[model samples]
Target chain A: MTSDILAEAMDYIDDDLISQAYSYSRGRPKFSKPLAVAALVAVVVVAAVAAIKYSDAFITAPDSGDSSTTAEYFGGFMPDKISDGELEYEGTPFTEKEISTFVEKNKYDLIGAIAAEYGDFESVYKISTSGYSHVNLGETNTLKYDYVDLPVCRDDEIIAKITLFRSDGGLSYTISVRGKAFDKYNSIYQGNLSAELAFFYYGFEELIITPTNHIYRVHGTEETLEIDRSMNYYEKYATEYNTFSYNELTDEKKYITVKPLPEEQINDGSAYTSSDIEEETAEAPETSTVRTVNIYVEDLMSEEIASVEWGSGYDLMLDRPFRVCTEAQKSEMLRFIENMKPTEAAEPVQYYGGGYIVRLVYADGTRASVVLMGGDQVYFETSEGESPIYVDTNGNASALAEYIVSLI
Target chain B: MDDTSIIKLYWERDENAVRETAAKYGKLCIKLSENILNNKSDAEECVNDSYLTVWNRIPDERPDYFSAFLCRIVKNLSLKRLEHNTAQKRNPEMLVSLDELQECLPSDNLPEKSFDARLLGKSISDFLRKQKEVDRCIFIRRYWYSDSVKAIAEDLGVKEDRISVTLFRMRKKLKIHLEKEGFCL
Candidate 1:
């Protein structure tokens, strides 16, 4: 029976009708007195906190005419005139004679500080140049402690290794020769180290030694030394406020503006210029040592799978032609590998349910696969004929599987 | 456990009321939540919270139909979770379901002219009761549970286009029904 007549008569169910029927079938439930009271208290507390947090906006605005306090607050830090020049690292501020004299006076305290900072210095070596002596302190076992490698220059070459460690107290540095340059020094001085002799960099070029309140700024060859108060401010606040726009604070006249040097200065033949050093230091590392890795992901529930290969001269995920994984992505992948640890099992546990599968291929053509079934049953397999990994509980294998799944 | 016994357990103020209710309706609650959230953990959390809500409300009021009561609570809780999770973005399932009903519903411009939701629900229910069984089930499954068109088609053993056309025709009939009932959108 075709219902053209009924269609014209018109009346069909809609969302509202369905919702009404359901609701009418289920009578409304009222909350108990205790529950009602608890809910009321929660709402009141939330409202009170929100009101207190936003109450300041409701108060009258500060007097806009008061400019004296604002001026005084900024007067101490504001520069008079800023010059447009590339910052060149001019080495340590101390001369050869001055460094020798300071080291002689504070050698014991310096040695003590180094010992305290890096357990103890097993040996000290020195390399003398025409102007200054390059000091090297070797650790008993460099692998015993965690250290970050910082490049230190000696005789215009980045051959010195500076290991920096940060503890709750402060920073400790251990400067040493890269290879067998320990025999070049005329004498080896070793003693207890103190905090005053710990050297830190102000910028890339300036080496700052804090014996007390005094700071020495050194440059290469040109020794036009000045006790600039602005240098102290630059060391203390430059990083935090270097990009301070004039409009964001006071008028343009109140703040000194340091603009970039002309492009000609950057291109012109200049020895040890900031632009040249930045370009050399910021270049990507050599890709010859990069490992090739492949990740495969499968959704067992849908029986759908996809994979992406990453390495030198190979990347399948990127839309552009012939582009490999970026340095950041490589670092992330390495970090994941460093933290990955799977549980070992005697045999593969069979599960006939749906889940996810993740397979990883290492640089040496070794393959590892993890199958995550329902209820936190994770089975892992490797091509090296190792025992299967089974994680009965939701633990590292489950988390690793999830992380791998996210990568693909 | 049956719905009647679960309600009786609640009436007795026993903690097993929650366990029994969950044993029966947990999967359905999670499915409803997942339909809106599209996330397993969030749906699970919403279902657990809905059970707590039932526990709190059962002492003062006894529901005639416990399943419908639970569905209402879980649906509301899932919607609230959806609101919180997608504050900056819209949930696609929720958007699609609401957009489909927007044609027959009133525009947002008439905010001052508030309509009673329960009254509208009754009028719509009367209209649905008059329709064929297949058409009514399709409409309820689509709008009430926020089920996808493909899911509705699969459940009813029909093609997706047929379900879509049927919904379209039902909407037209609903529009005529609302006009006859003197409700202006």
Candidate 2:
């Protein structure tokens, strides 16, 4: 079940992000015209979309029951003029046919952008994905599509379909602009059409189309007081606290040498030479054992602590080093440990909330460990038994927990 | 006045800081509290409390992001107020948002491990940075601001269904990401 930790975690999001949310709410662009593009792109039936082959791209029109769109003005596709690897946008090579195929395949909802005042259209050398609604097809003159639709983004790839809708079926061309253009166009357009052409673009603004939303329900409870206790622990401590892993054994290694028995000595108790024993010892597998134990809170309350090592998880798996705690803080923690009263409890199955394992090293090279769970409960790892011996610290659980977390 | 100016006033122990902060962010704080409490009076009271808390804490503690710091305090106070409210008085909209986020939790009972809220927050921010701007905007609006799906959709000029669908997909991705990050639900 989701705990308050998740909500608390939201509070911990980068301050700038929280500020960005405010900006989004305050700076959201208000569009003047009302568009009725079906909201759910996933459910929207692809209207009897007819592809009008214009230049190298296929200009698909929503089944607007007009039959007068198939004339010389609606330039047909030039199969022979299909350029091969001639244009590239955002590292993705797009041939004339490829662009047509992409637009046709996705069947992206198209918004009509009526190109105002077309000049001499020369060879299509490059497909610019810049934000400018006006594209220089060739000469100094720019082909301005007053109304621009926000690009459809698919996995970081922006493929925007600009359908050049012309009155009188005047060479209706379709151009594809992909990649970084989406951000650029979105910043400029801000969901508003160009106000320069209020006459033609006014009523046409209702054709603005939005991208489809793909459905995916991908993967969270509370329970009794015990569960609530666990929930409280998780919600309160899991997110607010820091955990440390305690490596119980010191890094010092002691090598031990073992000599194999002589073959004859095994059956007849024959004496083996010291040189032979040395040779066997040299050939034996080298064995090294950890020589020192870290100080535990239980065993070394009176002893001076040399240092402390901590890890995030229980299995001594270190994620990051614990922040250096002051000597006074260490003494205080030791005092808390001394004052802690042993309490009866069930076997420590799992904290299922939050905790850290702390290993204390004494000045005399001895070591001990204390498992701090949910701030209130402490477990002294004095034995290799199945269950941990739990301890209660009266009503100072939160203070102890805070102290433990602070040590991180 | 800007946030820095207001913060400066706080440092100078000038009471005008509270007034300036209220003038600038009172509406936002009230809106945020209202989203959670679903009670205008309660929301206003929480905002006032937040202002007092900020007034008391500041000068001693100067936040880098003054607005966000205030927002966090206000949100915490609002949630606390909601907790104290009776079930009948609780905001169902806020509960719905929380319930929806609950769905993002790990489905399988992986052994619970202690997680740093800051670390998780970083992970979430990283995930959001990789998302589309619109998606990220929608997410922060709904989760951070506690905005309803319809509200988010209206703000973004999209359908509520679209917002719902996008949220669903994002929640799924988040669950997967959290699982991969070794976080237990």
Predicted complexes: DockQ each: 0.04, 0.18
Off by over 4 Å in 1: A1-408, B88-90, B107-114
* Candidate 2 Cα outliers beyond 4 Å, as residue runs: A29-408, B108-116
lDDT of 1 by residue, B1-185 (tens): 87779988988989999998888778778877787788889889999999999989987878766776787778778877876885544347755765676566554565423545555666777877776545565676666767788766544333465466557656756776877786654
lDDT of 2 by residue, A79-169 (tens): 1111222211111222334334333332212211111001111211112122122211111212233212213322222334343333332
lDDT of each: 0.39, 0.42
- Candidate 1 per-residue C-alpha lDDT over A1-408 given as tens digits, one digit per residue, 9 for 90 to 100: 012112111223243444443332222111111333333323322232222121211110111111221111111111223332322221233333433443333333333222222232343412211122111111110111212223222222333333333223223223332222222110111111222222222211122333332433322211322223443333332221111111211232221121223323322423123332234334423322222222221211111111112211111111011111122333444554544433343332332323355444434433455455422334334432222222211122233344445544
Candidate 1 chain B weakest lDDT stretch, 10 residues = B153-162
What's the lDDT for residue A8 in model 2? 69
lDDT of 1 at A82: 30
